[model samples]
Target: MEKFFHFVSQTGFSNIEVSSLVMLVIGLFLLYLGIAKKYEPLLLVPIGFGILLVNFPLSPLMVQPENGQPGGLLYYLYMGIELGIYPPLIFMGVGALTDFSPLISNPKTLLLGAAAQIGIFGTFLSMLMLGFTDLEAASIGIIGGADGPTAIYLSSQMAPHLLGAVSVAAYSYMALVPIIQPPIMRLLTTKDERRIVMEELRETTRRERILFPVIGILVTGLFLPESLPLLGMLMLGNLFRECGVVDRLSKAAQNELNNIVVIFLGLTVGAKCTASHFLTFETILILVFGLVAFAIGTATGVLMGKVMCKATGGKVNPLIGAAGVSAVPMSARVCQAVGQKENPSNFLLMFAMGPNVGGVIGSAIAAGIFLAVL
Candidate 1:
């Protein structure tokens, strides 16, 4: 009977505290969001499971081995993130799946993507003003990029201590792109701007498509070698898709490679949300700053879109500018939704894809700049 009580005491229930319970609840909520609401199920599901696993007391899956015991699975999986392997591979998958023809068709939308990065720098400066170290500021600012993998990669490099907060903030904002970006976009753009219809994208030549990936690597890598690991793999994957001879390899990258990396990346990132590291005033500040960055990114994209609209003599729809956030298809869809509300025939998805794809490159370039300068 005494041994039974001892065994029971050794389990998670006895070690669970308010903070652990809170993390568990947060994990459960993420699961509910992923499973019920279908909010970024690929991201939230594995991450939610990680949170649930780590919050349990003495969970061997998340902890280091002690007394000759084997370390937890997460402890090992985390090395991929810490060593910066996952983000580039994820980018590779992104490249494999992405269609860059829209961006090639309208190069001007690249400006909108670049404009969106103002949020990243803006938040960086703001965090500095708030007394965060330079590295911490850089990591936190990246949350505004709306690129979860990039956020995790940079945070793992610069501020591993703040990894959990910044990563969660990045992914949460990404998942909430639909809810968060529309209001900001609406507040910044007029009904006329939203209703503006865009000209159909010019068809990009197959040769242009084939050359883009190679040229992209040369230009970006020449300027920002630190970005090569990411940009190289991204372009490599895109080249696979465009090369006309590697369909099987491209499909594998898009499906198997991407899925595997996502599971590992999400679980590893979620494991960082340990109660001891996550529950703090600093974490709260990071969250607020991240939201500010996301808002600023959206606002800047729309405002830039408005400028392009006038510059193009109404040829450009300002609505597509909001897709400049690196939330990929989601941000583009938000643009479509908002535009449709104003003009039902304004099919902005193709137009928005230009900035959507450019935003991915823009954020990666920003990460490289941060890495180079600081």
Candidate 2:
């Protein structure tokens, strides 16, 4: 009877609290969303599982070493994030995979990308008014840019205490981009604006592609050296792809290296969402503000598209402007989907890619500015 009692006490059922139970349910819901609904499965799946793994009562996964006891496996893995390693590596892979030709061919779209940063700064000021410290506000505000890796990097640097909440909020909004962005795109643009077709982009030469990353790095290095860690890796990866001389390195960065880093990054991010870290009042506020920032970003992007449409004598489709958030190809695809719904003849994917890729760069620069000034 004594042994039996001891064994029962050792089980999770004995140690589970209300908070643990709540976190577990949240984890399961995330899993369902990822596996069943296919909403950013690559991101949500690992993150969801990490939430489950960490929520178990007396779970050793995140336990720190003490009194000669070794720490949990995830404790070691999470250091990559704590030390600001994974996000930049992920950016390198993104660079390897990105085709900047769209932005290069149409440099004007870069302004639409810059316009989206208003959400980041806007949220920053709002959070400050709400009483969050500059660091915390900066971290939370970054969620507006809709770039997970940049958010992770900045939050990890600026507000390590808020990392779990900031990371989850950034990624959650990113995953929800498809559901969240369409209405804003539709509300901002008229039927005629949605139906407008862009002229096909001119072919970009190999030399231009090759020169871009180099020039980009030099200019950024001179102006905003703080951004180099993320932007530098991004441009380097793009260089590897464009230079056409290091197929092996480029492929490795794009495929194997990128995949490995994402798994680690996702699981660690999820692991950070333990009940204590994630269930606070601040966490709730972060989530709410994050959604607002994203909505504002989407709205602003489409408004810019509208302005450009008028400026271009109706040559531009306002739908593509919504892709200015750094959610990568997903937001661009949403623009494509919404435009096609209005006019089956419209093909906005390639055109939207201009602002989409530009957003990635713009968000990185925004992060850099935060790091530099604050």
- All models: lDDT? 0.92, 0.93
lDDT per residue as tens, model 2, 1-374: 99999999999999999999999998899899899989888888989999999999999999999999999989999999999999999999999999999999999998888887789899999999999999999999999999999999999999988998998898888889989999888888889889998999999999999999999999999999999999999999999999999999999999999999999998999999999999999999999999988888888888998899999999889888888987997999999999999889888999999999889999999999999999
The weakest ten consecutive residues by lDDT in model 2 span 110-119
lDDT of 2: 0.93
Residue pairs with colliding backbones in model 2 are none
Off by over 4 Å in 2: none
**Every model: Cα RMSD to truth:** 1.0, 0.9
Candidate 1 has its poorest 10 consecutive residues by lDDT at 57-66
Pairs that collide, model 1: none
Provide the lDDT at 314 for model 2: 93
How close to the true structure is residue 310 of candidate 1, measured as C-alpha lDDT? Answer: 92
